[model samples]
Target chain A: MINPINIGSIDDIDEGEAKVIPSDETGTGEDIAVFHAEDGNFYALNDNCTHETASLADGWIEGTEVECPIHAAKFCLKKGTALCMPATQDARTHKVEVSGNDLLLYPNVPAEPVEA
Target chain B: MSDCTSHTSEANASIGRMSRPEAFTQNIDVSTLVDSDGGLIDRSIYTETSIYAQEQRRIFARSWLFLAHTSQFKKPGDFFTTFMGEDPIIVTMDKTKTIRAYLNSCRHRGVRLCRADAGATKMFTCTYHGWSFDLAGALQSVPNEKAYPEDFDRKQWGLIEVPNVQSYKGLIFGNWDKDAQSLEENLGDMRYYMDAMLDRDPEGTEVMGGVMKWTLEGNWKLAAEQFATDWYHVNMSHASALMVLSPTGRGPKAEIAATPGRQFGSENGHGAGFPTHPKSRFDARPVHEYYDYEALRERLGDAAVEGPMTTGHATVFPNFSYLPVNGSIRVWHPKGPDKMEVWAWVLVDKSMPDEVKDAQRLYNLRTFGPSGIFEADDGENWSEIQAISHGFVTNNVPLNFQMGIGSERNDGTYPGQTSELYSDAAGRAFYRHWSKQMNTPAWHERTEQA
Candidate 1:
C-alpha cells in the first residue's frame, strides 16, 4: 500500500510542462519530476534520467515526450519509456491525481536491492 | 683568460632539471595498489607524485612511444617537435625521406633548437647562440669556435639522437631504450584494431590541418584507460552527446541492442573494445552520412569496417590512444601526477573530399576536441576525482574495478583476453601489467622473468 502526498497546486506548472520536486521517498533522496501534459492530464516520474544523473524536468518537452537536456535521450512522458540508444532501461513511473485543484503524487517504491 | 664565464651554465641548469632522475627515498610498494584478482586498484596511483616518477622510469622509459604521423613529414627538411615522456624531441626527414629524431636540445649550450611546432627547413639553428645542425642531425656550424681545444671534434657534438624510432602504417613512435621491443611487436594484438582505421581506405590516412592542445588536472592513465576499456560509461556519461549527435535524437536501437560489444586486454597493457557483430556499427547519425561507407566496405570488407573495428578505440599502452569512428589520435602527456597535457589531432582518409573532410573535422572538434561538449563532460569527472584525492578520507577509499572479475576468458570471437563491454577486465589487465612494470627495475629484468 502507498499514500498519496500533496505535491503542489495545478497553477504551479504550465500546461504541457514539467517540474521536478525533491523528495526522500524510498530514502533514495532522488527527485520526482511531475508533468502537466497537453492531454489535460498530470503525470509523475523519477527526476533522474535513467541514462545518467540528469534532471529530466530540465529537458525539452514536446507533447507527452521529454528530451533530456544533457544528452537528448527522449523519454515517453506518459509511461517513462526510454526512447534512445544511451538509455535502455525504462524510467520508473509514478501515479498522480488531482483533488480540489491540488496535485497528489504516489511515487513507485524503488525495487529492493538484489544481493549477489 | 677569456672574459666570458661558462656558456653552458644557464642551459645546463635547465637541462639538468629536465634530465635528472628523481631520487627515491625507498622502493615503491605496488602490492596494495593492485588487488589479488587485478580487479581493483588504489586511487593513489593517480595522485601520488612518487609513483609517477617510478612510472616515468620503469614504464615510460622502457616503452615505444607514439611521436608523430608519417604524413606530417612528407619531404626532406620537413620536421615536427614533440615529446618522449617529458623529454623534448625533434623528428625530421632528410633528402632521401629517411625519418630521424633528435633530442631538441642543442649540443653546444643545450638550448632547444626547433621552437616552432612544425615546418620545413634545411637546418635547425639554436637561437641562444649561432649553433646549427643539418636535417640529418649532423653538426653543421658553431659560433666563435676558438673557445674550445683545437682537437674538439664537432662530429661528437651533433644533437643527441633517440636510440630507436619506428613507424607502423603512418604512425611514428620513438624510444629512448635501445633494447625496447619494435613498435609492431609492442602493438601485438592491438594492431588488428588499429588497422581498422589505418587500412580503412586504400589511400591511407593523413592528419588534418593542425593539432589541438589543452591541459587538464588529471592523471594520464585515466584518459588512456577510459579510451581503451570503459564503454560502460557511454550509457551514462555521454548519453547527451549521443542524443545530440544522432539524427534528431533517433539512433538505431536495433544495432545498439543487438551488439553490446566486447573488451580486449593484452599482456603488454594494450586495450581495445568493439562490438561482436559486424553489421552493428554505432555511427547511425546523419552527420556521419558523408563518410564513404561503400568505399570503406569494398576496401576492408564488412567484418573489418562494420563491427568494433569501425566503432572502437584503443591505446598502445602507457599513453598513446586513437579512435576509429572519429579518427582522433592523442597522446596524454603527463605534466605531473595530477596533471596532463593533451595533444590531439584528427586523421582523415586521403581520398576524402574537401567538404567531407571539413565536415569530419568539425564533427571531431564538436565531439572530442578540447572545447567539445563530450570532452567537457569527461573533464568534469576526471578533474573532480583528482581534486577529491587530496582529502585524507581518500586514503581509505578503495576504487572498484571489479565489474567482471572472474568472467574474463578467451573466445574465438575476438583476440587475446575478451570480456563483455559491461566489464572492467581491460582496466584490471592494465593495472596487472602496470604493477609488473612498476615493480621491475628495468625492461631486461621484466623480459627475463617472462
Candidate 2:
C-alpha cells in the first residue's frame, strides 16, 4: 500500500531550487528532502546521509547534487548516487507528484527480503 | 634436601636482586617450575619482565607478524597504513598488483608519507620537502633531479622495505629480521588450526568489514596470555555477557565441572584450551541460526562444529588469536612494554549469506569493540595489572603462577612432540621459551640454537 503525502502547494516554490519542509505531518519516522529541479520535475530523497548517518536536509543543493555538510559526500537529487568515498551505499529515493496546488510524496520502503 | 626448604630457598632467591637475564634463564628451568608433587605453575611466565623483553626481540621481531589481509589493497596504487611493532609501515598493491610493504617514512626526512587512513594514490608525496615514491616503492621524482651529483642514485634512496613480507592463507605478515625462519616454519602446527578456521570454505575467508583499532592499558603479554589458556577467567570475567547469553551460568559449568579437557600447548608455542563439546550461550536456537555456523559446519564437516569451537581456541604463539564462535580473529600489536593496540577483524567464509555476515559483524562489534561488554571486563583487569606492577615493592616481588603443580606428565597422545594436555603450564612454558631467548647472550646464538 502506498500513502501519498501532501507536502506543499505547487506555487510555493520557484524553478532551479528545492524547498525542504518538515515531514512531521506524514507520521513517517524518516524526514525527507524535497527537490524541485529546473525541468519542472519534483524529486524526494531520505534527508539523512547514508555514510556517517548525518542529516542532509540542512545541506546545500547545487545544480542536481546535494553536498552533505558533515563529510561532503555528494548525492544527486535526481538519481540517488552517493558519489564519494565514506558513503559506499545509495540514498533512498522516493517518488514525488504534483497535482493542482499540492506537492505529494510517495514513500518507498527498502526491499530487503525478510529472513525466514 | 627437604622439599619445604628447597621451595622456600627458590622462592626467596627469586625475590632477591636478580638481573633480567638471570630471571629469563630461570624460565626454561623445568625442575624449578615443578612443585613437590610435580605440577606446573604457568602463571609465573605471565608476570616476568625479562621474559616480556625477550618476547619483544625473539617472537615479535623475528616471527612473521600479521599486518593486514590482502583484500585491503584491491586496486592498483591502493595502500593501507599499519604498524609492525612500534615501526609504522605502509602496505600497497602496485599497478602490477604485486603486494609490497615498506616503512611509512619518506626517504628524504622521514616524515610520514600516507596520512589518510586508507586510499588509492598514484604517488605518495611527502608533506615536508615534496619527495615522492610510487607504488613499487621506487624513488619516482625529486623537485630538482640534478641537485645531487651523479654519485647520488635515486634507486638507492627508496623507502626501506620490511625484510620479510609474506602471506599464507590470505593473511599477510611482516618480519624485521631477514634471517628469521620462513613464515611457514614459524606457523608450525598453528597452520592446522588456521586451516580449520580459514580454509573450510571453498572460496576461503574474507574480512567482512573494516577493522577496529583501539588501545588497551595492559602489557601485550597479559592480552596474549588470555588467549593462550585462561578459560578459567570466562565465568568470572565475562559473567555479565555469559549470564545474558547462556541458558544459565550453570550450562558451561555443568559441562566443564567434572573434568575440563586439558590445555594443548603445541611445539611452536601455539596453545589451545580444549572444551569437551560445543557449548553455546544461545538458548534453544538452531545451531545454524547464527548464519555462518551451519555453513562453516558443512564446510569443515565435524571439525568446524565439533572440533575448533567446541574443542578449544588456538593462540598462534606470539600475536594472533582465533575464536571460532561467529569466526573472529584478533591481532594484538604491541606498542611498547606496557601499551598495545588491538586490531580485530571479523572473519566470515566468502560464500556466507549476506544476512549472516551482517549478523556476525554486529555480534563481533557488540562483544569485542572498545565499548564491548566482554572487552570491558578484560580491559579493567589488564590495566590494573599494569598499574600495580609499577609500584616499587610490588614490582620487586614475583607474581604467583603455582597452579596445577606436579600433575603434568608428558604422555605420548599427539604424535611427534612432547604432549602434556594437563595444566596451565602452557603459560609457564611460554615464559620459559620467552626467558630462554631473552637471556641468550646474542641474537646470533638464539637464532643458531633455534
Stretches of candidate 1 off by over 4 Å are: A1-116, B1-27, B248-259, B276-301, B443-450
The whole-model lDDT of each prediction reads 0.75, 0.64
Model 2, span B246-340: residue lDDT tens: 55654356554333455655545566655444553331233246446676667656543554455355576677777766566778887666778
The TM-score that candidate 1 achieves is: 0.71
Give the per-residue lDDT digits (tens) of candidate 2, residues A14-78.
66455665557545667777776555666677887786545666455666677764455688776
True contacts kept of each: 0.00, 0.00
What are the runs in model 2 whose C-alpha is more than 4 Å off?
A1-116, B1-57, B248-253, B256-259, B280-287, B290-304, B404-422, B440-450
Candidate 1, pairs of clashing residues? A71-B240
Best by TM-score: 1
TM-scores of the models, in the given order?
0.71, 0.66
